[model samples]
Target: MNQPPLPEVLDLAGEHFHTDQYATYRDILEQRPVTRVRFYDGSLVWLVNRYEDVRAALSSPRLSNDPTQQTDIDLSAATGIPDDLSEYFRRNMFRSDEPDHGRLRKLVTREFTVRRINAMRPRIERITEDLLDKFAATGGGDLVGAFARPLPLTVMCELLGVPEEDRTDFQTWSQHVVESDPAFAERNAASYRSLFECVRSLVRRRRDEPGEDLLSALVEQRDAGDRLSEAELISTVFLLLVAGIETSVNVIGTGAFLLLTHPGQLARLRADDALMGSAVEEVLRYMAPIEMTSRHSLESVEIGGVSIDAQSTVLINLAAANRDPARFEDPQSFRVDRNDGSHLTFGHGIHYCLGAALARAEAEIAFGLLLKRFPGLELAVPTEELTWRHVFMRGPVALPVGWR
Candidate 1:
């Protein structure tokens, strides 16, 4: 089968933000689950859009997550970002393979475990109530700016032992790294400086006077056994700060938007507490935050009738795969009662999101409380009128919602 043209990939991305690409994604999955396309820098890569193909691609040992192994595809060439910014990305767990990925992931997984996350539920509920209370006083507000953004950032800052006074700066820095457009190089540099300096200061403070937070725990572990390196410490903080904030914010923000927009789905979820977990899963599947993640083939592999060469780049379209009609019924509709867990939003295999439990806990508290607190909640603006961030990891820029 002939591969999709370069423009098709770009067109798909463009269509995704402006309109739902459910039909296009379904067509791609059915026609060419593992098809090749050119990235922004004009390098060709296999783009997988089917759930099974994406899961296989993620788990395949023939594929490597380490960008260092992808010498043929320069980070700058592939992403249209300066090579200097690549160093910041390369140091992180997201770009690492096993042993390294496992090591970094283990350092924080204990804190993000299901038990710890669930334990934080009451506190999360308190925090959600407090934020909603403030919003209630204002009559109407930008839900994303007023509630969604601050809630996750506050939780992450608290987890990492970051001081309250310094969180705003960190939030600004992290956003720059994720949305590094208009001027990718300069924004990333600023992000890196803020992040490194903040983490370094926190690490020093924790070393001197350890606290009860997760960062303090990690610091104590490092000091006691010399298990983690200085580089790992900073890199782990970077991961937590970036991943912690971006994923939670988008998940909560987008999930609420979906619920509000789909009244029938919202009604069902509100009527039954038993459906909240399934609602959360459907939310993750239907409005996946991270659209695509890249991996490189370590050896030649055949997938979906195409032979992917060794060292070839492969991009898993999480959004596309989750919406595959093969695995989902009425995939385009935001039905919370669907109760399917076949989503790739948290990824698959070993590279699955370590913070999945924590994110879900936060979202559950967020949406459950949101509906209860604002039973009269309704969108202040039309769906088409609301602005959306035009990026791979997409979310509503501002959700103007009103309630009595």
Candidate 2:
């Protein structure tokens, strides 16, 4: 039997979600849902492909997110992330387990509740319409830069009470934090330092002059009973800013790209407003922002007949899991009618995404108003020529579009 193309086979697949490779990966899944492979650093990792297995591994108590519990596996050394950059990810809810995760998540959960997100719909709709107006006036523009990137940045800025004037600076900081090029260590360091300093300033200001925003609330919590430490506050803000902007930006860009490319799905969503919610779900499934997540095994474990040793790195193939043929029929096809919410795009169980609701809200309004306002919207350039950001998250760098 032919084996699937390993990471060695396709070097750039790490940054770009090569859907074309899923066919080969699907075949691998049939043999064993979890397969061991060597990463670029020659470090071994278990790739979890099957949807059920991915979900199971994510929710399993055996899996440890706590860096303390797991053996030494420095993300900085492994990924070329500098000490300070890695400091941003050192410890928090995402890397913590159980009580810590629950406590940290609860502290900020109220700010992102479904109702709160829904309340922002009217404001989001206004933001969408205003952005569409700019695109409409220009006849055609780069949708990713003009619309997709700005909408989420705007929402996050408002939620965090960041002044509108500071958003441009904030965007610059975020781009560097997620930089994929391991070669540019000096450039990455400069940007990482700038971003850290910016966040620190914001935290200090919030501490001095508390406000209605999340940062202030968190600062108050920290001051009261030491609910959040300075490091935790910085990490939470960094996570919210990066995860908030990047995911929504790509979702809008990729979802819009898919809609424009798939006339049938576009028409289905355009004709019915009620289908907007499910349409967003399909878009998310089709274009998962965070394609993969890294996890390290706490102890030796048996998965798919293969023995994964303790301290082994693991890769959860989220993009592949969402498109697994075993779970969904015509997995490659873009179907707005599909109602399966089992997609691991936002992850599963305890590690489920905290910003899922806010993301859905932003996309629902952004896409809904986009189609309604510019019915003639079509790609300005040939799809093949469009540049894709070859990062952990994939999206068109610039989605230029034209309309009547």
Q: Report, for every candidate in turn, its global Cα lDDT versus the true structure.
A: 0.79, 0.77
**Tens digits of lDDT, candidate 2, 206-286:** 888889998888888888989877788787887788888998988999999999999998888888778888888988887
Deviation from native of the Cα of residue 113 in model 1, angstroms:
1.5
Q: What clash count does candidate 2 reach?
A: 0
RMSD of each: 2.9, 2.5
Candidate 1 has its poorest 10 consecutive residues by lDDT at 3-12
The residue ranges of model 2 lying beyond 4 angstroms of the native Cα positions read 1-24, 30-32, 67-74, 77-80
Please report the candidate that would top lDDT against the real structure.
1
Poorly placed runs, candidate 1 (over 4 Å): 1-19, 76-89, 180-183
lDDT of 2 at 306: 68
